[model samples]
Target chain A: MPAVHAEGLFKVFGRRPADAVRRLQDGASVADVRESGATPAVIDAGFSVEPGEIFVVMGLSGSGKSTLLRMLNGLLETTAGTVRVGDAELTALDAPALRRLRQERMSMVFQHFALFPHRSVLDNAAYALEVRGVDRATRRAKAREALALVGLDQWADQKPGQLSGGMKQRVGLARALAADTDLLLMDEAFSALDPLIRREMQDQLLELQASLGKTIVFITHDLNEAMRLGDRIAIMRDGRIVQIGTPDQILETPADDYVRQFLADVDRGRVFTAGHVMVPAPALVAPTAAPAQVLQTMRDTRAGSVLVGDGDGRVVGVATEDVVRTAVAAGASSLAGLPLLPAVDVRATTPLNDLLAAAAQDEVPVTVVDDDGRLAGVVPRGAVLAALGGVPRPAAQPPVALAEAEAVPPADETALITSGGIRG
Target chain B: MAESSDDSGLLPRIPVGEWVDTAFDWVTENFEPVLDAISTASGAGVDGLTDALLLPPAILLAALLALLGGVLRSVRFGIASLVGLLLLISMEMWEPAMQTLALILVATVIAVAIGIPVGIAAAKSSRVSAVVRPVLDFMQTMPALVYLIPAVTFFGIGVVSGVVMTIIFALPPGVRLTELGIRQVDGELVEAGHAFGSPPGKILRGVQLPLALPTIMAGVNQVIMLALSMAVIAGFVGAGGLGGLVVTSLSRLDLGLGVEAGLAVVILAIYLDRLTSAFGQQRRGFPSFLSRGGTVTTTAAASSRSVDAPVTGATDQNARPEPAR
Candidate 1:
C-alpha cells in the first residue's frame, strides 16, 4: 500500500469554508470561490505516494503546495477529503492522536531551518525526541548519530546562531532524521541555501535516502531540483495538480500550455538520462560463441558490431566486424580468446549532458548498465542528439541517423543541443 | 456670579474622581479580610528578605556581588560593581540600599511570574490579545503615583504598600513585552514545533520560551527600572529606603543628604542594569570565569565526536552501497 494517500482534498480559507468547498465541488471556478468571500487554497487535489519514492510537488508561491503538505500531516485540517498515512486516517484522528502520529511516524524539515536559536545544535536536533519524552541520554545519542549522517557531529555543542546557513539547514535535517520516522515532509528544505550549497545539500539528501529508503514528499519551486530528486513529480498551478509524471514523461508530453511554458526553460540535456534515450542493445553475442557465429549475429542484425556478454548478461566488450573477421581468419575457436574493443559503459541514470564526451570518442554506441554492470540498453550518438533537439520528436518517428544529424553545422548543432536556440 | 449667570459652558463637570474614590471605599470595606491577608504575607516576605540581605557583613556582600558580576559578565563589570558598592558604603547608604534592593527583587519576581504566562496566553489567542492590549496601555500610561492611593488603602502606610505600588507600576512592561516577544518569534519555528508532534505546552517551554528569553529579559530590565523609580515615590507614604532619605532631605532642603541618597540610587541602578542586560546578550562579551570551564569540556567532547564522524561515514558508505531503485 502507498505510505501516504490523499483523495479529493479540498482546503478553503476564510468565511464559510465549507460553502466554498461545496461551490468548488459543484464545479465553481477558483475565482467564483474567491468572489464568495472565501479563498480556495487547494481544490480537489489527490495523489498517493508509494513507500520509498521521492514524490515532488513543484509550483510557485501561492500554488497552495504548502497548504496541501500541512493537510497530509494533519497540521491543517482539510475542508473536505481524506488523508491516510499507513493504516491511520489522519483526518479522522483526534488532535492528540494526530500529534502522536506526527511524533512517532512523520517529521518535517522547514525551509527556514526553524532551529531554536537558544539551544545548542544537538538539543535542536533532538527536540522531536525530547517532546516524545525520550530520556536525555538516549535522545542525545540518537541526535549525535543523525548529525553525523549530515557530517555535522562536530558542531553539535555550538548554538544555531554560530553555524552558517547551510550548517543550520543540516541541523534541521538532522532533527527530522533523529525521529527515525518512515515518512519525511520537506518544505523547500534547500531553497534558502546558496546555489552551490543547495546542490551539495541535494546530493547529501539523495545519498542518505539511498540507504534510509524513507518515503519523502519534497516540495520545491525549482524545476531542476524537482527533476533531479523526484521519482515522479506533480506539477501544480492555481492550487490544482495539472500533471504527474516522471521527468522524461513530462518533458516528452506536457499536459497543457502552462506545463509546456514551465518546461520551456528546463535544461533537457541535464534532465533526460541515458536510460530515457537508450534503445535495446542492437545485437548480443555470448563470450564463448565462435567467431563465425559472432559475425553472423552482427550481419543478421545489420549492425557494425555486437556486444559480447557472459552468460550472466554482464557486458564483456564490443566485437566489431573488423575484429571478428581477423579472429575468424586466425581460426579462433571462440570469440572469448579474441581481443575485444573496450566498450564505453555508463550507468542508466547518467545524464545525457555527461554522455556527450563519451558519445563523441566511441565509434560504437555507449552501453547502458544497470547494477552489477549488466547490459540494459545502448545510447547511440543519434539518439542523444535527437533527445536534445529543439522539438521533441514524435514517438512514431524512427531514430535519426548519426550521419544526417551530424550534417548540421557545428554552430547550429551547438545551438540545437543547448537550451539556446539556433542563430538567425 | 456674572460669569456663572452666562451659563454657556461646554458641559457639566464629570464626577470621575468621585466615582473612583467611592469604588476604592467599597472595595476596602468588602474585601478587608482578603486584603489584610495579602498585606501581612507580602509584608513578611519583604521584611524577611531585607533581614537576610542585611545579615551578611557589608564588605562580604559587596565582594560577593562583585564576584557575581565578574562571573556572569566580565572582569571589568566586576570591578565596577565593587567600586560602586564601596562608594555607597562610604556614603553610609548601605542599609537603605540593601532594603531597596530587597523591595525591587521581590516586586520584580512577582511581576515576571504573572506577566510571562499572560503574555504567552495573549500570544496564542487573538481574543485574549485584544482584551489585554488596551488594559496594558491604561496601566502603562497612567501616572505612576496614582497606584499609591489604592495600594495605601489596601495595605495601609508601610513597605507592603510600597511593594504593591511598585508591582502595579512595573507590571505593564513585563506583560507587554512578554506578549510581544512570543508573538515576534518566527512563525515557521512555531509550525516546526507543531509539525514535530509536540503538544502546545512543550512547544511553549522548549521552543517559544527559549527563543523569547532575550526579549523577556529586556522586559525584566524595564520592570526593575520602573520598580526602583516607583519605590522612591512610595517613600512619601513612609516606606524606608534611600527614597525616604531623599524625601526627608527634600522636606528640610538638605542638599548633602539628598545628593548622597540620589547618587546611591544611581549606583544601584547602574549595577543591576549592566548585569541583567549582559545576561540577555548570551556569551557575546568577554568570557566569564564561571562558563569557561563548561565551554572547554563541551568543545573537547564535540571535537572528539567530530573526528569520529568521517571514519564512520566512510565505513557506512562502503557498507551500504547505493540501491538502484
Candidate 2:
C-alpha cells in the first residue's frame, strides 16, 4: 500500500475557488485561471509515495512544488480531489487529526532551517515532540539520539545563532528525526544554504535515510540534487507534473523538449560508476607465455587487463584483449608475436567523469586496476557511454571523439587531466 | 395739514428731495459714535499669559530633554544643539525655554511608565489590540485644542491640565507603534516558543518583547516630541511654560517678547527632537545586543564587525541548503 497518495490534488486561491476549479476541469490550465481572473495555485496533480522510499518532486519557482508540499499537511485545504496518508484521508481529517498526523506521522523540515534562534540546538530538535507533549525525559533522550545521528550531539546546547548554517540545518533534520514520524517531508530544505553546505546536508540525509528507512518526500528544484538523492523524481512545470521516473530512465529518455533542455549538458557520467558496467577482460597467454597461467588469473579476476610478470615476478607489461586487437588492426605490431602492451591503467576508485576525458583524449582504452596499481581490467569508450544509460550503437558508428583529442596536453598536466573527461 | 402749503410759500422753490438727502448725510457723518455705543471686543490681554506661566513646568522639561537626547544621539546632526542655543539667546527667552524643558522631562517619564505596559499587554493579547486599536485611532485624530477643553473641564486648567492634554494627545502613537513592533517580530521566533512548548505569554516575554522594544522605544520618542508641540498649544488654556510668554507678548503687541518666546519654543523643540532622535539611532545604528530588558546601553558600538562565520568541514561542511520538507 502507498504510504501517501494524492489524487487529483488541487488548490485554487480566489474568491471563487470552486468556480475556478470547475473551469480547470473544463480544460482551463493555471494560466487560464489568470486569463479568467483567478489565482489557481495547484491544479489536477497526482502522485503516490511508497513507504521507506525517497520520492523527489522537482520544479522551478512557482511550479506549485511548494504549494503541493503545503497541501500534504493541510496547511492549505485543497479546493478539489482527495489526499491520504496511508489509509487516513488527509483532506477529510479534521484539525485535530491533522495536527496529530503532523506531530506523530509526518514531520516537516522547512527550507529556512526553521530552527528557533533562541533555542539551544537540542531544544530545537526536540520541539516537535514537545509540542505533542512527549515527556521531557523521553524527548531529551530521543533528541540526543537524533542529534548524534546527525553528528550534532556535541553542539546540543548551542543556540542556532551560534551554529553554522549547515549545523543549523542538521539541527532541523534532527528535530524531524526526533519526532520519529513515518514520513519525513523536506521542502527545499537546503535551498537557502550555500553550495558546499548544500552538498554536505544532502549526504547527511542520504545517510540518515539509508539507516532509518523512513518514507521521505524531498522537494528540490536542482535536478542534479534530485538525481543524487531521489529514488524516483517527479518533474513539475506550471502546476502540472511533466514526467515521473527513475533517475536513469529520466536521464536516458526525457519525456519532452522541456525535460531534454533541462537535462542538456547534465553530466550523467558523474552519477554512473564503473561498478555498474565494465567489460570483463578476456584472458589468454601471450605467444611467449603459457595459456594455463593466463586462464587462471582471468578466472580469478574478471577484470579487463592481465599483468605479465618477469622471471622475478616484477610486472613487465599488461595485456588487454581489446587493445591487442586494436594494435593489430592499426598494423603497429601484430598481437601474435609482440609482448602484451601496457596502454594506461586507472583504479576503479577514480571517478568516472575523469576517466571519460582521459581515455578519449589519449585515444586509448584505460586499464582498470586494484588499489595496488595492478592491472585488473580495461574500460573502452563504449562501456562509458553504456553506463551513462545510453545504449551502445552498432559497430558502424564510430565513437564520438572526446573533445580533448583536438588539442595537445599542456606541459604541466596530470594524467587524469588528459585522461579524464571532466565535464564542466 | 398746515405744512405742505406753508413750505411752498416759505421757500417758493425748495423741493422735498433736497430735504431727504440732507437727512441721510447727517446719519453717515454720525455712524462711528453710534457703533461705539453698541457692542465691544478685547484686542489682547496679559491675563492669558499670566495663566499660562502659572501652570506646571515638569512635563515641559520631559518633552524637551527627550527631544534633546534623541537628537544628540546622532553625531551627524551635531549642529542642532548649537543652533538651538543661538535661537534661544537671540530671542532672549532662555528662562522660559528652561522651564519648558523641565515640563517635557516629567511628561516623558510618565509616558514611558504608562505606555510600555499597555504596549506589552497589547502585544500579548489580540483582544487587547482590538480594544486599543480604535482608542488609538480616536486619540490620533482628535484635535490638540479639543484635548485642552477636556483637561480644563476635568483638571481645572493648570500645568497638570497641560500634562493631561499632552498625554491624551500623544499617547496613542506609543501604544500603536509598540504593538506594531511586537506583532512584526519574526514568526520563526514565535514558533521556537512552540518548540519549547512554552506558553504564548512566556514566548512573548522572552522573545517577542525584547525584539519589539527598540521599535517601541522609537515610537515613544515620537510621542514625546508630539507632546512637546502640544504643550505650547496648551498655553491657550492656561497651561504655562514658554507658551505663556509668547501669548503674553502677542497680547501686548510686543513683537520682541513674541519673537523671543517663539525662539524659546523652537529651542525646546530642537533639544527634544535631538535627544529622542539620538536614542532611535542608537537602536538601529548597530546590531543591538539581544538583552531581555537588561539595560542594554552599549556606547561606541563596534561598527560592521563580522557577523557571519564560515562553516568549515569535510565535504558536507557547508550543507545549509534548506532540505526538502
Measured by DockQ, the strongest candidate is: 1
lDDT of 1 by residue, B245-322 (tens): 989999999999999998888888778866775566545544555565357434533543443243234323222111
| Tens digits of per-residue lDDT for model 2, A1-424 | 9999999988887668899988889997666677766788777899999999899999999989988987887767889999899889989987667767776688888787777665688987888778788899999999999999999999998878998888888898898899898988888989989999999989888888888999999999999888888889999988888999987678766899998888865567765555333333323234454444433343344334444544332334655545544544555532344456655566664557867765574334565555554434446665676656456434543322222222323212322221222110
Mind giving the per-residue lDDT tens digits that candidate 2 earns over B1-325? Answer: 6897887788767677667557656654566454223211100112333335435453453345334443435323334555556556456665566555545555666666777779878977899988988887777666656676545644455666666666666676677667777887887556534433355665677678766765666677666766677767767766566877767877799998787776667666656544553455364442232331123333322211111011011111212111111
Model 1 lDDT, residue A209, Cα: 98
- Chain A TM-score of each model, in the order shown? 0.85, 0.75
Docking class of 2: incorrect
For each candidate in turn, the interface RMSD (Å) is: 0.8, 4.6
What TM-score quantifies how close candidate 2 is to the native fold?
Answer: 0.60
Alpha-carbon local distance difference test for all models: 0.82, 0.65
Clashing pairs in 1: none
